[model samples]
Target: MEKQILDFSLVPLGLCLLLAYHIWLLHRIIKHPTSTILGINGVNRQVWVRTMMEDVSKNGILAVQTLRNNIMASTVLASTAIMLSSVLSIIMANSKARPSEIVLGAESELGFWIKFLSILVCFLMAFLFNIQCIRYYSHASMLINVPVKKMSSSHLRAEYVKRTVNRGSCFWSLGLRAFYFSLPLFFWLFGPIPMFLCCVVLVFMLYFLDVTFDYGGVVDEEEEW
Candidate 1:
């Protein structure tokens, strides 16, 4: 029994380490976006928007359409997050509805509920961040195509538009990260071993998804602008 306890303890320890590593990586990306794939993509996106805004004569139509698409996409994600949160809350409220028992054939009530709560938090955060993303996007859409004049106000509006869109993108990325984190938590309901393995796999998947091929080129161009 001692040995079994020791083995089980390692599972939570490994999970904690994995979560810490994930958080550290995100912090690094935020601090130095050009160093990571996802960060680089974000930089590129900002550059693209700024470039389009600077040359409204040639890109005005495309910019408006892109912002509209972004708003639509954010809306869909927000709705999905809300639905998932609702479902999870209902499941969590039912004491007898243990996921471990249903999915893993285990009678570990405590572990099952813990896992459920983790998943629930992920969905709730995703929902909240997605709503914020939608708010920024909505505000950005109105400013993105505003008529450019030789006035200082026009330049300020352009700057605000870029900042708003960038903020929206950040929130959207965070919502997606919450979704990614939930995958491992869901597998955790089955067993710690699977959870650990899923965490490793998720790190690899996120690394690939977040890293961009353009490197620091986009960031450099934005700086020059």
Candidate 2:
């Protein structure tokens, strides 16, 4: 019995360490975007956006259209997060609902409920952050299309637009991160062992996906649609 307790204790400890490491990695990438693929892509995206703004004609049609696309994407993510949060809330409130045999084997009632609540919180946070992202995007849409002469004031306005867009992008990234974090929580339903393994795999996958490799002084700045 003592051995079982010791083994079980490792599960929560592992999970805590995994989460801490993930946060630290994200902070490092954001602080030094040149070191990672995703972060570098984010920097390149801002540069491209700034260039487009500079190239915009007096009518600013191109900037307006680009912001419209950003708004649409943020709207979709926000809507999805809201819907998932609602579904999770219903599932958590229903006491009669039992864990599925496929995902959950012998989890205690309290443990299962706690996991469900954690998942629910993730979706809720995603929803809130996405909504905030939409707000920033919407505000930037107006600012990006504002008429400005080619002067210092215009440069300041352009800088403001870039800052707003970057803030919105950060919020969008956070929302997506919440979604990613929830994946291992879902696997935790099966067992702590599965959850631990999934967390390890997730960290490795994220590292590869996020890290950048440069070759021959070539920088890939193409944004995928």
Candidate 3:
């Protein structure tokens, strides 16, 4: 038997796996040598650019470049996906039964366009998310190249403090990451409460992830894209 989206178990199982994966991945980064995936030296690096690159697992200009690529991919795919979704909405709006009609007259243009849009949206969304992941990976890379000369005890201690704050981002980014792979349940729109909550939570996650790391450290001077 083929599985259908209407089947109840699949959604929960998928979310559970996603949640668990994020929890585990966070644990790994927190315990890593840099307390981040990309190696940026916090000691002498500039704060803002370093932070951005480190978040992407890239350093300096490289991270921005990575972001540029991601933005492009996301724009293309997201636009296409939205277009498809819009078309589908248009379709469901115009469906009318024509049981008496034969052959070419049977299928309505409205229904076909709607179905086609829904399918096209699915493809676009998938591609968009794939490139988004590179965003996180490049951020992690920014932390991979720190030059460890002696820093004041205070600076080192701050690093630990920063790590604790970054943990929250870990959870949030992981959740946002989940959206990349999670099925686009368009019907969920009917239940406004849940969908709104999910979006709110995601926004909070990205916000925390950004703020937590923004001031803490910078990538090494030598490390540029």
Candidate 4:
């Protein structure tokens, strides 16, 4: 038996927000310059643009694959949680039932429902990831093949140099990295109340690494694809 659950209402909102954020990112990637001029304070010099469209398209494909993987992982996670939660709910719902009643029927029903809900959420999430994967991969491939100058970076090939604002795979890889940090949603379960508070420490750590400026010169060898 399903009880009144507040989290159900949140699913739609969370999905919408994630969709909007990704859509916005895809738009910016397709429209914006390869190396954005960061007007940080006043010391704004041109930064190096890494990975032209070809590289980015490859990344997008991988991102699509990663989304597919996430769908599977989250499916397991959500199913387990939902099933357990539902079982607890069932036990509470039939408080009047004797211990035998709870043991014989209530537990089994709750477990079944939880597994079903898990599959449902997993299916939805998998569909969403697959759609985005195809859309992004198509965008990236088309952009890479197009002959247009999207940036002024002389380091890239003449063919790629002419083109600017084409879909690249870097965005997807970065997105994947971001997702990895969130795998299993530990932060949501037991972390700080506000994200800002936790991120402050992380931001400082990232900033310190950024300032270190460690690097090896770009090795322009043909990748063994």
lDDT computed for candidate 3? 0.41
Query: Where does the lowest 10-residue lDDT sum fall in candidate 3?
Result: 97-106
TM-score of each: 0.81, 0.81, 0.32, 0.27
Best by TM-score: 2
lDDT of 3 by residue, 1-225 (tens): 122232235435534554565565445333431333432322222343336424333454564464456445545554555565576555545547332231122134543444345444554555445444444434433432333343355445335434422332333343345344333333222222333345445445543443334334343343321
32: Cα error in model 4, Å: 1.3
* lDDT by residue for model 4 (72-130), tens: 55445445544544655565566576544433222355544443344344433443443
Write candidate 1's Cα lDDT for 1-225 as tens digits. 553463387567756766787787777676656767666656667677778888788888888788788878878888898899898888777778546646573446666667678888898899898889988888877677666774568767766776788889889988988988788788766666777788787777766766654554235544321
Residue-by-residue lDDT tens digits, candidate 2, 65-145:
777887788889889988998888777777676655323654566676777888888888888888889899889877776
Of 1 and 2, the candidate ahead on TM-score is: 2
Model 4 scores what on Cα lDDT?
A: 0.36
User: For model 4, what is the error of residue 89's alpha carbon versus the real structure, in angstroms, after optimal superposition?
Assistant: 25
